[model samples]
Target: MIQLHSGSVMLQGGVPAPIPAAGSGRDKTMAYQILRRHHRGPWEGQLHLTFDSLISHDITYVGIIQTAKASGLREFPVPYVLTNCHNSLCAVGGTINEDDHAFGLSAAVKYGGNYVPANQAVIHQYAREMMAGCGRMILGSDSHTRYGALGTMGVGEGGPEIVKQLLRNTYDIAAPQVVLVWLTGTPPHGVGPHDVAIALCGAVYGNGFAKNKILEFAGPGVAHLPMDYRIGIDVMTTETACLSSIWQTDDAVAEYLTIHGRPEAYTRLAPEEGACYDAMISIDLSRLEPMAALPFHPSEAVTLRELLHDPGDYLRQVEQRAAEQFGGKATLSLTDQVVDGKLVVQQGIIAGCAGGMYDNIAEAAAILSGGDVGCGPFSLSVYPPSIPVNLELMQNGVQQALLEAGVLFKPCFCGPCFGAGDVPANNALSVRHTTRNFPSREGSKPGDGQLSGVLLMDARSIAATARNHGVVTSAAEVDYPAPAPVRRTFDGGVYGRRVYFGYGKARPEAPLHYGPNIAEWPAIPPLGEELLLQVASVLRDPVTTTDELIPSGETSSYRSNPLKLASFALSRRDPDYVPRARATQALEEARRSGAIPPELQSVQKALSIPDMGRVQIGSVLFANKPGDGSAREQAASCQRVLGGCANLCYEFATKRYRSNCVNWGMLPFTLAEGTDFPGCPGDFLYVPQVREKVTRGDEEFPALLLTDSGIHALTLYLKNTTAEERELLLTGCLMNHYAAQNAAENRR
Candidate 1:
């Protein structure tokens, strides 16, 4: 069991005394300790951080670079890598796949960044291998850009955040309320990193206990777990919706960096005495067991033993709960899996960055060393996180063992994690050890006639299920080796052989290649004095994903093509969204140019207000909780593309989504928790100088009800807008800010 030490104290004498743990009345919790290490001045009660570096995978790179280009970014100041993994099949949207790669190369050369071609490695795997170092921060366009296990305070922010970094703007936010993840005990036999993360998510998600807080993982458990194990647990913290996470470094972290050939980057981080924490969460690793997030979300969990005792009852409850998630559009039946009074799963996969690590897969291999997967529809697939991880697993005989067991091993690719590959047949059930199992993330089309589903289990449970020929089983029933005979070493030169790394060559004259599909962002006007918007799309789901904003599979090709991709905004939910939004855009253009459209004018005349007041028109999205998964910037940019002005929300699912709204020049406004946003379709709500307020760091702004009720005021909080954020708002977007800056530089 993991051993956690609570005796640790502030190591340095000069750091400010740590703030007390919230609700505990105690001053020295783990959160306060780590916060002291990264502590700088309040910088005016809000801090704007310009990421020293940034990253993105195939799923997101094209979109980020395209946004940068549209914003008039001349060159990338910090390092960025574009990996081609999600669009590996080359099946979707014709040449859109290859064209993205070509665009990546040309853009990388033009911007002086790094480019890793498709199939070379998955994004996080490559990032862990090449990007992370102690005390450094990395911003990735992908949601799971977490590398805190490596002592790098890596954050997965939306593409707009990436654009800001490329444009040399800061990540502006209120100093997050820090939370101490105090851990103790080792995970019991058969328990895995997924188990720990799932448990933590369940504990803190429902109550916003750690929402927008910096998760400082500490305690004796910090040094007890192996590096890969820590990495596994660390990546999943994104699902907890925390602002970002960092861990107190020790020898293990040092060893990880040393092995990866960047020992110099390793530095220690911890909280000072009496460090402040907004909350405290205690984790007992010894208590964690083989866990499964049944369906829909990582928080819906049950122990394998608990599920096994009454499989039918448990399965029925899960199916019933899933009905509410699909907008009640479809039925998810799991009770049918009970055959001959025993539950049998259809498939198992241990793949992607989450499960592809050597230590985890090697244990799975040992369990299935000589077992057959059987000749039924039941199937098993193992994917390595990267070429190097795959090779080491090979040399360790894990590959041969799995192959003999009838398991199919795939190359390094993020396809399984985000709907790129291994799509199951309709109505089939598959379990995976991946970062997420969001609906439609498994490459299955929910809007289609038939539907497929996925459940999350550790590599061990997946192997056990594979061993029993897909009959449900828990990893706890079996005994496996704890560690490999020897820790694997890295030999991943595949990228070195293929990718072009231009480390800081300021070649302003380099020509960029733009494909026919690649298009510039539609012109967006400065933030207006008043906003009059129609509710283009209203999502009532628990959490709205970026994928729902703009699909990923075939759309990856169009990511570089703003107008093309924007046409598909909310394509899955409201097929009519693009048309309605485009129509509104015309109305917006008329309003912006002081010319009301004939149709709108006629409608306004019928309402007795022939001349609609001069106001800027933009699309408004109403959602209970949005921005659940993926740090994709398109979630906001697409709305910006469709003439969006602001988001009215009771709350946001992740801090990054809100930041995306600000960076795209869309006002992120929060309504009273229970207040209903009054708009059916054509209703108007006005928020004024939104531009100036956002720039001037006003905590509260007067929003108005644009009706006969006249000028009733409503308050919206800017929360943590920084100076750079204000500039982005004033200039209409980050891109415009950079363009003006670049032009000014040239003029000087």
Candidate 2:
């Protein structure tokens, strides 16, 4: 169903042609054109871009704004939207979630930004309705911030990038390669967008086919799918580890913008004739099947037919993988869910930006109409993307149809996708149409001996399985009449009633609201002359995600308070990480107070560095490859809060995570691929004149590893750091760098 070509190819007469050389300066793909327009700085080798707009949800907006405030932010430079979706449920912490909502409104008023209240709309949906436009670029704090299907180039990065945008700084990066995703043929009856997405992810994720590249969607299939269908597939591109995505716009895209009351935002966007691409991916949509991603990752996917035919083998493989992930702390057995040679699931969910679009929900309602979800442990729930979609569902009678079929409806919250809501019973299996099925994403505590399995499927199959009393049936095996296409009505009144649109109307005199739980950031120290790091944790996973670095469920309530949130860092994956990091922090405090701890006596003797006053002591973490998932800055900031100064890895999984590390003053260090780690948890690594080396743009640093087995020579690398990023690391953090600049200007 998919083919990848590594050689350069040119689009001539709407067909691909083999090119002898890679793309040249004259070759302008659609991504190149859009990026050129957005590029503000010199674009010779790299790009320093400033986006047209910025967005953040509640879980991220609070910290982003706080950083900007500390850097002397007066008003928002561009349009900014703050949506309350991730923490909208307000059931976790006592009054903290609501307090965040109120704080968002107050910040919007004082800083001239927009704020969407809880249940009004999810972050991406709100952007789709009001913010996305052709030829424009947007930056968001959430990883799945893709509006490419709507003719916009949306880039998701950590909050530091958004803070830079808020402060009118540029997003600097090496120009990425553009990959053409050529699609043709219409999808089969049973195939949904998620099925196509799962297939694409499985093809590219493991081999890094599209890593850090722009995916430009073009070809005959763009004209065949509806706007919502294209969006459903586009949002899942984040799983492929790509930088961003965009699609060629046609009449269907124009009509979508017109229906949403923004006709002027629509524009034809297509690659010029003879445009060259660095790589190409060809997909045949008709060959796709209803797919499911088994537990542990979204890339571990297989067709439903393939899974049901041999359920035992697949179940056992998943169980073995879970054992390796959790180290046998909890048991995960999908084998028990099989009965009479048929697979069964205990729960079903259709929610979030990827699965909760209007077309998916409407089609699912039609599939489940007049069919009852049997009253067992199995249950089904649906959440619309926005209040506008909810209103349309009610107007078209889809809501009543689903309600009559024993399907519960929830608000527009992101909890279901990220483990804050809809937790299953111990060891129960859930079939969901959400974004991710990573371990612990369903909110179960494996360290406490509780585990649950989640299989990712499309809404159609989830509805079909619900209709069959949760027998894990496919939509192709069921007979249901297709729903009539209903004209969607854009209800701007919903947002007018709940959302606060304060852009261009800043009230500088407005008082800021502060809740008891909301606290300022802890002080971060600047880089020292010499560095001494103790390895705190070592992970050998093939790819470590941000979810493992810092979990996303109830702990998100303490995001505004850095120290409190840091306490939960790696709580799920490494139960002893926080305490170990804290102990290292105590030792650092003693060193700063002119007293060396007894723990460092052996290290001082080993390195013969008797003067401990010149060396700064902190902790480090080593992983095979880290930062695969979310764009939350807390993944790196939490480590920094607990005296972490460096990360040792084979390579970083995504650019956003590495940016987060640099912006938070952490040394993003990497060792050679086959090199063995020289230090252990209690060992120390000493790097002389580390601050001077980084300031001088040095990539390689020779260091000494002090261990119980004596000292050894180790070499670390810091690659691809921009001048501003290096200064950010040397000056403590992005906020500190900007604060120092403001202070110098004040003195001038």
Give lDDT: candidate 2, residue 410: 96
Question: To one decimal, what is the Cα RMSD in angstroms of model 1 from the true structure?
Answer: 4.0
Best by lDDT: 2
Q: Model 2 segments beyond 4 Å from truth?
A: 25-27
Report the alpha-carbon TM-score of model 1 versus the true structure: 0.90
Give me the overall lDDT of model 1. 0.74
Best-performing candidate as measured by TM-score = 2
- Per-candidate Cα RMSD to the true structure, in Å, reads 4.0, 1.1
Each prediction's Cα lDDT score? 0.74, 0.90
lDDT of 2 by residue, 685-742 (tens): 8988899999999999898988778889989999888888899989999999999999
- What range of 10 consecutive residues in model 1 has the weakest lDDT sum? 2-11
Candidate 2 local Cα displacement, residue 629, angstroms = 1.0
